[model samples]
Target: MPDAAPVLIAGCGDVGMRLAALLQVHGQRVLCLRRNVAALAPGLPGFAADLADAASLRALPRGIRRVVFLPAPLAREAVAYRTVYLAGLANLLDALDEPALQRCVLVTSSAVYGEHAGAWVDEDTPPAPLGFNGAILLAAEALLLARLGESRGVVLRLAGLYGPGRTQLLDDLRNGTARVPRDPPFYANRIQVDDAAAALAHLLALPDAASVYLGVDDTPLPLHELYAALAQQLRAPAPGIGPPPPGIGNKRLRNARLRASGWAPRWPDTRAGYAALRVDPA
Candidate 1:
């Protein structure tokens, strides 16, 4: 493939836009694909095509060298996930000329680990996904590798993402609506949105990127402790004890492999990250 070939970002959204900005700073040619071209920023080169509709993808730009697939489903249902992650990914790969493509990175979630109960998980951990989302994503990961070869496929299993406009946790804490499980100490892991975008860009430039990497920050605090700290930061009343959040497996994600690959998070700890948000809204 020629070096001039554009890097295609499938399912372009918040993280995709951030990654595109990073790549554009370095003068890399970026092409974005999404359902709505109008939603894209002012001058970004993009195409409007729904991944669920195979025929719509036929008109995509040709000879794309690399891809970043980080699509979000229309809803939180099983059918939505299957359509977007599994069938949508399949349609994209099939539509493209696979021979000329160098890499296709998929942004999946850590839910694949499924209820670790405060245990630690790494990329090497065998996936035991419990919910439909995780199971379908695991299947999508397999499909990517099977179609594009393992060496050319990359999977980023990201922890909870929070930053910028994604401040629901902070809002909940401020209004005393936040509730967390405290008896068993449910763990929470996350990466700031900027850091998550940086990680995606890092993998794109990595020459010897691994097949799978965990996208999480350094600290994985217990849910109650994290909520308490946020409450303290906001000077609000602490959240009441309640049940753990559904479907999110309780495990501390280890990003050792990704860190070892020469990538580090700007926000290693959520406390400091959240503190920055307090000082400056965005």
Candidate 2:
């Protein structure tokens, strides 16, 4: 035995479970922690702990070497973002300060870029969050960088996640609720859920992970294009064009930095990724 604690996945949800599966295939045991232990995968030991509660974090195992912190806010509001991304992350960091810790990889949002004019962004682009959602995530990243530096921790800003069982786009198009930006053809990035999880695991083993990397697919497409594809698949009416929605990010996310790190998404584009996904009407 390595005489070390299992890898800790704080907030082990669907993506976390995916990461855990990948790691376990390589003979690694992962400690799964979340507010709802029942949600964890079978055959894995899980702890019910809320990152927002400092005391609950005390239940974290000793001798943890690596941590993947990925807690999603229960809501999209600012206060909810602050409580989960900021306070919850702070509590976890406070609880795990052991010398045995090797790295802490954080999953964040691409909203931190704040580019609403179809600009291309990457790790080097200075984060200028325009909304509270981006602001909260940026604040968390700042805190993480200040607290752990590049050697001990890194951040992964992921694009929109879509994959099996996650078909909001399909649902919207099928229900005649999908809207596309008419003028600028609102553009954004996306990554399949499996790719997001794989990116985290890739960061886990990289010898020199950068301070930050954008987790997105190679293709950045207009909202209408994505919607149209789903419409065709669902045999529904094409999505109508309208003014851009409030949070429909108008920027292109670049994944070269992550790709340069030798990680490429299996589903490199929305067309290929969404091919096998179907929205369940039940």
Q: Highest lDDT among the candidates is held by which one?
A: 1
- Clashes found in each candidate (C-alpha, N, C closer than 3 A): 0, 0
lDDT of 2 by residue, 191-276 (tens): 99999999998898787778999999999988888778767767889988787767535889999999999999999988878876
Clashing pairs in 2: none
TM agreement with the true structure for every prediction: 0.96, 0.94
lDDT of 1 by residue, 1-282 (tens): 225888889998998988888788778888889999899887688989999999999988788868999998999999999999999999999999899888889999998888788899999899999888899999999999999876589999999998878878888887889999998999999999989989988887788688999999999999999888888888889999999998777889999999999999999998899888872333
Error of 1 at 147 (Å): 0.6
Model 2 Cα displacement at 205 (Å)?
1.0
What lDDT is reached at residue 65 by model 2? 87
The top-ranked prediction according to TM-score is 1
Q: Candidate 2 regions off by >4 Å? A: 1-4, 278-282
